[model samples]
Target: MPLFSNVPALRLTLAYAFHDPSSLLPHQTIPTLLSLPLPLGPSLPSLDGTGRKPTIRALVLDKDNTLCPPETAKLHQAYINKIEKVKECTEFSHSAHSILIVSNTAGSSPAPEHEAEAKQLELELGLPVLRQHPDRKKPFCGPDILKYFKDHGVTDNPREIVVVGDRLATDVLLAREMGSWSIWCRNGWRNPAMPGRDYRGFFSKTESRFERIMTRGFGNTAPLPKAT
Candidate 1:
């Protein structure tokens, strides 16, 4: 039996599921669910961008909040520190990994300020900026990232790439579709009301959930699985 054979019925029920919100409850307060931190066993060694891991060859990152805080007041210094940290992490590992910045700045013809920002980021991070135009409805969803890797001659399977970003809708969704692992930086900007609102939490919670789900089917120590 194929999966989703009962999907049609499920969809029918879901379509009218929200027709009567009042019928569900009367001023019911949902209990605040707090996620407990899991112990990082000694078996799980520290990951500092090095280590001969069996997976994740490339690191694709989002610039805005994942790398640096989004505060205009301290963006410059924060960015510089982020760059240094990235360099240190990558160099310490001594792994021949490629770093790419996938960002949503202006479109092809970015404003003067946007251009300047991109240039600054590029210089600081020592990586090329793959800025997607805002007008491009699905900026990251389009073939921008895939085309990037192809153009750069990255023939490895999508599973070999890891995407780190702040937003779940953009970064996580794109990674899922492309079959790439994703690291959601909890300190960045995010939308908590979306479908996966549960994911928006303290860094510890997000990291713990991510580790739990990814390690489920794979071996215990397997590098986190790509989000789907």
Candidate 2:
């Protein structure tokens, strides 16, 4: 099984989260990513105190809970509606190139079934899925993700991308690792119509609670990227 695929990343993320909980904090928190304004623009508040909006050329979205229910491939109707609204309301368009889904279970696991799941998600969701990577999962997969976007002709600059997900440790940390911005989905998809659990387990819930408690009082701002 690929369950162990995230063990290494998890260890590192835990240490990082404890040492710098603010780094795992979200720039903005919403019920779900679907609520984020489409075609995010400079009118949005600056991530830092500099008052300069970061460019948004592409988006990296998490699948489980963030877009759909945890451990499921089905896209919620709310998100589907939101995507259609985005296409109609703005020039910004979503395709396999402009928007991508990054999921630890569907794509980044080590098992072959995970690869098949990724392909299935691509076909069902109408967006590209990052292919399975044995060692590159979230936080650690930022470089691979950047290369994927670059090769696909999306923006090459990581600063131009925004990573949206429900998990602070993986999703938020991934953005920090990639030098991109982050949007945290605090509640995930909570619609009663959607079936299945939102969080993976008690560990997921406890860690998130801990991170929230630790990050309290810190402003909602993206931390400066480390020097290359």
Candidate 3:
């Protein structure tokens, strides 16, 4: 993966995150997406206590680390039970399009190689994950994502979608850009081979460390969405 492939995204993230470090914070943080409260129909009242409620209608998930181990196209063994539990919920099982895995690697390009990765992930997870054009990568791809949700009958409102990922620069920043909710996976899947170990790589670990340092003292409150 090229470090500077998405210069625009990096620039946007740096500007907003530095201007308001809180923008880098997520509405919530969890070990994994499946750890979210089930049924997934309830409204998340604003933390600012203005009675603002954003009901989630769709989910935008990151593939690497957030789902499986970093760079893998399959689910972590430790997440298998969680996946089974999530499947029981009507929100996920209702429609294949309700949840999407928007990985920067697998599906964020027009290349056939990326398309193949997307297909493999969909097959492994039994979900309707799709590929994206190179310009449609996260943070820069927020509008394209919203359009996808609308086209798929998920929801036209950006506030109704939530982005879940392990990265602050990409995932959380993407949600902030979209005026949507976000959930940061503080700890990704546990390594099945090594119990009690986080499944991550050196690059991911270093990036996460940098993110923490950059967003220190920030409150984990999502930015309020614009009125429809």
Candidate 4:
């Protein structure tokens, strides 16, 4: 049986909810309209690069939630620790892959806040950051991310690349759209139901459940498929 038993029913209801001309909550319903499912295509093995193995030559990381904990609005000393963790966990050998940051921040019209954060991240992580507008159109990962890797001579093999982020709406969805794997860090942002004193709050079980539903329903539109 399919995981979402009521897929067709839900889709029909959502279609009526969104497209019915006389619907009362059109505005509220429109935002929930689902896109066509993106095919998972074929599976690629791990990018360790043995023989004809797929070459994953870049790692795109999200800043606020994936690498650095989100509680601190701006960069802080704790970021250094996160940077270290990224370096240690990611495959960053001189030959195979490079790491870059992809993120969004808010501020004035032009949003120098994201730029400043990128600069701080560069200093802390000792790597370049690729920033994109929050409202990136289709090809949601942004062209610059691809350009950054191209300019640096990074390989284009999807198996060799991975994107890590906290928000499925932005990071995971974007990565999946770009045909790259994604890792969702369960250490940032929390729904009210999972409130706690420290870092545990953001890593709530409720958030996990929601993410699971969204990810499964959305196919590869998630950061990391549920482990096996």
Candidate 5:
């Protein structure tokens, strides 16, 4: 009974598609892959358009929820180690240019504060940060963002990209649109209605269906996200 799905046209698509997280939060949502031209994975989707498993290439990470809490000025100390370990994880180890932060800083108070924040984060992580100006923020994948990726040299194949974030409407949906993979971090912005979190009372048909889709069938491997 979530507010977004009351529309009659969406019920059937909600039933068969759109799944829950079977693996640990932020590991990677498998059901998001159902729309892919090929099958879902035990291995990664081929990025070269050759139907072979591709090594992880570029990562477009969300900042606020996935790496740190929202609206904070500094990088949370608790997540510093967790972020470092991402390089050590089985999938990633790309060159410095390959890892990018694609977070929204449009709403930051005092306007340019987000730029300073991005610089500070870049210094802390030793990685390039791409904090979008509010004018071209997330859920949009504006020309600037895509142009940055192109300028920095991502694979021509979009499937090689991986998006990690807390919101489905932004992070996951953006990746889906790009034909890339997505991971939903249950750790972000703490919404009761987020994919895996449970809420009270008789759930609406939409909410129940959403939970059912996102909670099951993933294989666990991702580390528990440490909080700030």
Candidate 6:
């Protein structure tokens, strides 16, 4: 047998994931989600006028309120069409560009449940999904998602990859650490900005007009916001 054969069963265990707060933009900036440039340009070290305009070739997204309500395990009713359009933007050649869901669910849920949920997401989205392995919760689990990228031939080209999420600490920091593009999407939940602040909220088209219209879509959320 080779040094390491195929993967083996993962032992159930408590997991933890961390992010570098200094590496991320302020969490409050997410309120301006739709205000940022679409398909964010690559931040690679500039080479005088190589002028290869960067194109977004891949996306790594968060799970919870970013795509669906917490633990609903399905695409949010509102995001259905918007996600499809975003999918179109990430597509290259005949196949859709890789869109991965990387989450730190190990601390919160058992691995089996997370795996099942990820499978459902893969079915609905027609893309890949990655979650913390039962034996390895993030930051250790981060390698699992990265391994999938490596296995699938995702390159080190930062211009071609992105990570979108609701939290700046985890998602943004992950992007920074990985040297990939970052896009933060905000919802009515999880405000780490206000340490002790307590409030409840709901999302509706009337209030979340941007989400309802999905103006921050590819090419649309340029200098002038456009919608599909």
Judging by lDDT against the true structure, name the best candidate: 3
What's model 1's lDDT at 101?
67
**Model 5, clash count?**
12
Error of 6 at 124 (Å): 1.5
lDDT of 2 by residue, 50-128 (tens): 7877667788888877777777777666778776565453324633476778988788775777777788777765778
- Residue-by-residue lDDT tens digits, candidate 5, 102-202: 77662322357777777778888877777554444554563455566678776555656667765555565556545566666543433323436532223
Writing each residue's lDDT as its tens digit, candidate 3 over 1-228 gives 333566877787668756876777777767666577665535354635656555677888888777777776766655656656666666656666878778888887767777788888787776666567687687778888888888988889887788888877788888888888888887765565674777655545765675566556442455565555
Better of 1 and 5 by TM-score: 5
Off by over 4 Å in 4: 1-55, 71-79, 85-90, 95-97, 106-109, 133-139, 189-207, 213-228
Reference-based lDDT, residue 70, model 2? 77
Better of 5 and 6 by TM-score: 5
Positional deviation of residue 10's Cα in model 4 after best superposition, in angstroms: 18
Question: After best superposition, candidate 2 residue 132: deviation in angstroms?
Answer: 3.1
Model 3, poorest ten-residue lDDT window?
A: 217-226
**Which ranking of candidates, highest lDDT first?**
3, 2, 5, 6, 4, 1
Stretches > 4 Å off in candidate 1: 1-54, 71-82, 88-97, 106-109, 133-139, 189-228
Q: What is the lDDT of residue 220 in candidate 2?
A: 39
Clashing pairs in 4: 56-160, 56-161
Clashes of each: 2, 0, 0, 2, 12, 0
Task: Flag regions of model 3 displaced more than 4 Å.
Answer: 1-5, 41-43, 47-53, 192-220
In angstroms, the error of model 3 at 178 is: 1.1
Q: Report the lDDT tens digits of candidate 6 across residue range 67-100.
A: 6555556554345555666666534322453677
